[model samples]
Target chain A: MKKSINKIVMIGAGNLGTNLATAIHKSGYQIVQVFSRTSESARKLAKKTNALYTSSLDEIYPYADLYILALPDDAVLGFLKSKKLNNFFMVHTSGSLPVSVFKPFSNKFGVFYPLQTFSKNKILNFTDIPVCIEGNDKRTESDLMKIAKNISRNVMVLSSEKRKQAHLAAVFACNFTNHMYTIADEILSRKNISFDLIRPLIQETSEKVKLMKPALAQTGPALRKDKQILSAHMKMLAKDENYKKIYSFVSKSILSKTK
Target chain B: MKKSINKIVMIGAGNLGTNLATAIHKSGYQIVQVFSRTSESARKLAKKTNALYTSSLDEIYPYADLYILALPDDAVLGFLKSKKLNNFFMVHTSGSLPVSVFKPFSNKFGVFYPLQTFSKNKILNFTDIPVCIEGNDKRTESDLMKIAKNISRNVMVLSSEKRKQAHLAAVFACNFTNHMYTIADEILSRKNISFDLIRPLIQETSEKVKLMKPALAQTGPALRKDKQILSAHMKMLAKDENYKKIYSFVSKSILSKTK
Candidate 1:
């Protein structure tokens, strides 16, 4: 039988690090050490997780069962290459990076990518966050899965390639979707209209997709192919060439989705 | 004080018509008649509101305090010109069309646009839906505002020009936003990943905007300006030229928002 993941050391006290470490700590696992480039972030997360704090990776507790590298994507590879691998398991919480990044350091490594956006100030409930996990070996996968299950109910043993695709999908759904709202906010603010006026509509649009496929939930001049209204809307954006291009291109794309 | 709106004639039994009529009827107003080009649609909505149903405009009950034209934007002007108007107030539920569309038909006309997407089968709560009301005259404005307030808690006496801009903003926030989800769904389905995996992320993105400006809430490769990941994502969409263009263009737009 594989040993259960008990003691953890969280590296990089950024947005994801703070939330993930706190979650693991709350799930009855002991977070042994919290590391960050800045002592303030390290101390802040360490206090929250009831763990020891360090500003340097050299000072990370060597005896922890798992070390979670929650640093930025670029920092992850260099950090993994430089660190000496012990018998303990290690994982990085990134969607785009593959599990093989850990191959140079150790075979007892995996990935624990929670597919959600994190902000330092925002409190998160990890109970339902979809944590995409992958391991280099069966034993590592099982251990990581157990630890992931303890924190999130929605844990999937996704492949590295699939994790990359999920990350891309999220860029469109979360990032591009938020950009659409930013454009709307910009348009309204131009006329001195409050963003609150569209908040209910925004809430309903997101809520509608939860109940049905977004393709089916779509409604607007674009979907209707109402040229008059579409041209009028385009004309309104004539002064802003970038917005007009977006309006035209996205509208055509949406039209193509019509059955 | 203006006369309180009580009796209503709902023309068009489409999505917006059904939802608006139901909400107004539920607010204790009498829906005198429901009109639609399709007899079945008229019958369906009429039965729901306990009102008379008619497929012909000539058979419409004309004595109601208000006539709500919830028809498509293009159909509104033609229908207004074809029908004879009495002294009773009339309003069309459109975002893009101006209140001046009524001046060619009747001086007693205005606009009562509820800024939310509607589906025929979906039940809606009008309490918080933003109902933008515009009137040709002071008396008409008061009557429409009273009628609007009864159905929705969020009512505004907006001008026609601002209403058009609000509608434009909604095209971005609601319609284009749904398209972004559609793109994400397409990408995930290509890899056989269930859209369910991203639902939590989609929900959190929307919820974040409610708390903060979408610009501030933005995350992902575009916001991070991670060149490696951005190019990686763009390469993934190489097969679909349309999607690839959107990925590149939208990423540039997102990068522009960084301040």
Candidate 2:
């Protein structure tokens, strides 16, 4: 078996791209080139990975075995349209965009979506992270799997439509859930309570769902039909009509589910 | 200092009561007696803890040093009204009720609130759990702290009103957050998508808030003002008014905060 994929090129040196480059480099892959709209970001990542950095896509090294477009979803298609090339294997690390966007560029196209929210400073463990991969062909699929497996222990092949559904779910699970936490923070701050008070409960709620289906694991005043507590909470959130609506809507949903 | 509080007499065997008794027993404390309204539940927990069980409050052993009242908020006052006790340090593990609830029964009254959600099968780590304690006097505070420190590393003496506020925050952080997960589960299930797909993202959202304030850590299409994606999600949830309202309200709240 081949030990690893050696030559790689990365576009967009933002959070996801930088983290992916760092992980790939740490796994002993040679990052051949780095391209970003910003020279500073590209140069910083290049210096860390010992890769050649260029602001221009025209200066990109063409010989790299795998090229990754880690730009935003809207920007990815534009970047692909401008760069006219590639019989080589290429993939985008996006959860929402369709895989067929690469159809115009290369036959050896796929997706390498690491299903986790990435931020600039947060260092994530890729070992257990689900890397959803899909390829245009069998050989490309095999190659993507091999590379994905090298960087992560969990990898699965999912169709583009399924990946799109997963992205929608990710929005609810990660992004929307974080918004709920922010709501809690705001509510607590207004009442002069520390956010630390809710940290353990948040951790346990997540941990519980891992053991049971989230629906079965669900518990609260809503599920228990504790109208007193529910009304009290609603009154507390009265100033924020948006939060009040969420509180009532979710409570009713939970009540319906339990019934 | 005594290495452990050996003889524990639990005064209520409801959800919190049974769970806390089991946790304390598992942590090597001897649960000497289980007291509750229902003999069946008391016997069930007593059998698990190898302790004597009784439904009659008068049958409770007078020798136990630590008495935990884990009954419902409304029931605590009634339980105290019925029980005549003296010379024993009593702690009610509740976030909402005041320490004065136990003042009529024992001068050594304190609150020993385990700041996490509890269920029958879900075993929790007491070491990392924050125990919010409040005492009527210094000796009671010291006794409660000693007991709390035995089970958990993090313990704080918060006022009863502050603890009430913390409980209110918990409604948002734990209860309402889990409700969001339920909504997400329902959304995916309706789409014929597996909830497992969003598990990683759900876990990451909670984990992220541990390191950064949820307000600073917020991210979503809402924060970016990506009306296209937001509209797409809303359309998908259009048939379900509950979900549509939730999506719009939460998105607007997040966007307002970002601005």
Candidate 3:
């Protein structure tokens, strides 16, 4: 097995795959091939990296030093079971899946999970995005770490269990947090208020967490336990049962955490 | 009433009050006095703004152009009721309360709500903070807008009802969003992972909404309707009922908003 990973095959041209391939390629690594279920996705990503594109698994470049499976968790296992191209060092970029998933498929494998939300077309600096790495062996681990270090300054070796926990935490912090913003947008739209008005508040709230513990940084009517304001907000949300439920549930949750 | 508000009295020395007083003072307004329930609180904020400190409502400067009741919503009314210093134009910084809350106390009154979370020690730039202004009359609105514009580049005249809705939206956007971070912290701590791992994701989530509608920026297993990953995350949260409830509730909320 090669200890130094130079040439790469990205097996999924999705959001993570596209961003990872582009970033890795930009860092002077050779992107040998790009593969996706759709030729359009493969072509689009391949064009950015100046690499070949393919929609079929059989068409993937087998000579690359590494194959990055940036597919969904299920697809990762499915792809491995479908093919026996285990000559290269393999890694699946999944938060929940373990490095052991590649045990039956490849003798040399690891997990290279970049822990960040990636949306296609959004320009991102991969320098600070946390890349969680785990390998079945020391050489495989070192190879994975080499690629990860080249792309990110924030990299850690996390076990599958720990990585999964971080993933669960991210779902709350990123996904659910965005949902809160969406609800706020919905609420503001009802009153014809522009979402721009609350952008600073949202920005400050996120910025505060970076500086202090989130619990210590929390501020609002709920944390204040202002019954008057809480009830007033609940009444305002009364028209929408879902929002009302959310407001009450989250408020209660906050109150419960109060010391 | 004066069309220009230069001399001001700040009532309350809490997070919002201290920050607002300092910002307003720094903007060249003369903060004549600072009041708080605790003398030490009043004195500390007073020292920053070069204003007199008072714990008693009776000691408040009666001749200032504006009496900013940066107190709690109830305290605003309480202070007004407890004193008849209605000669000056009055304004309260609150999201939920309407300008009419001051109708019984003074004719020259308005709402000067700076829509951002403020920490007492954290230095913040008020230049971009949205200042929602509402006044009882044209002259009062003009006066409040004058002061607001002095401190913030972003200022708007929003009606009481609309301001209340905006406040409601802010509770969701800021308060609830922070709670999500707290929950994420809890989840991460269980596996001994640093909170730093998810900061980039959280920061990006907030950054995305500034450029795009949050609903469009949403990415996760819930939004993607990946039942397998969703079930796995739910299982991970199974031990903590509150966290589990929050996880399932928010994931469902995200799914409901899905295209």
Each candidate structure's TM-score, on Cα atoms with residue i matched to residue i, is 0.96, 0.86, 0.96
Tens-place lDDT per residue, model 1, B1-87, is: 646678899999998999999999999999999999999999999999999999987788878888999988999877877765545
lDDT per residue as tens, model 2, B1-259: 6433579999887667877788788878899999988999899889978999999878999888788888776677777777655657688887777788776677677898988888766656688788899888886687778777877888889898778767777777877788777777766776687777778778888888888998777766787687767887788777887778778888887878776
**Residue A236 shift from truth in candidate 1, angstroms:** 1.5
TM-score of candidate 1 to 2 decimals: 0.96
Error (Å) of candidate 1 at residue B40 is: 2.0
The residue-by-residue lDDT of candidate 3 on B1-259, one tens digit each, is 3246678989899999999999999999999999899999999999999999999877887788888888888777778888557756888899988888887777788899999998888868899999999999998898888889999999999988998899899999999999999999988887788898899998999999998989888888998788889999889877877777777788888888777
Candidate 3, which segments miss by more than 4 Å at Cα? A1-3, A84-88, B1-4
Model 3, A1-259: lDDT tens digits are: 4246788999998888988999999989999899999999999999999999999877778788888999998888889888657655789999889889888887889899998998888857899999999999887787788888998999889998898889988988998899999999998888778899899999999999987989998889989888999999888877877777788889989999998
What residue pairs are clashing in model 3?
A: none
Please report the interface RMSD of model 2 to 1 decimal: 1.8
Clashes of each: 0, 0, 0
For lDDT, the strongest prediction is 1
Better of 1 and 2 by lDDT: 1
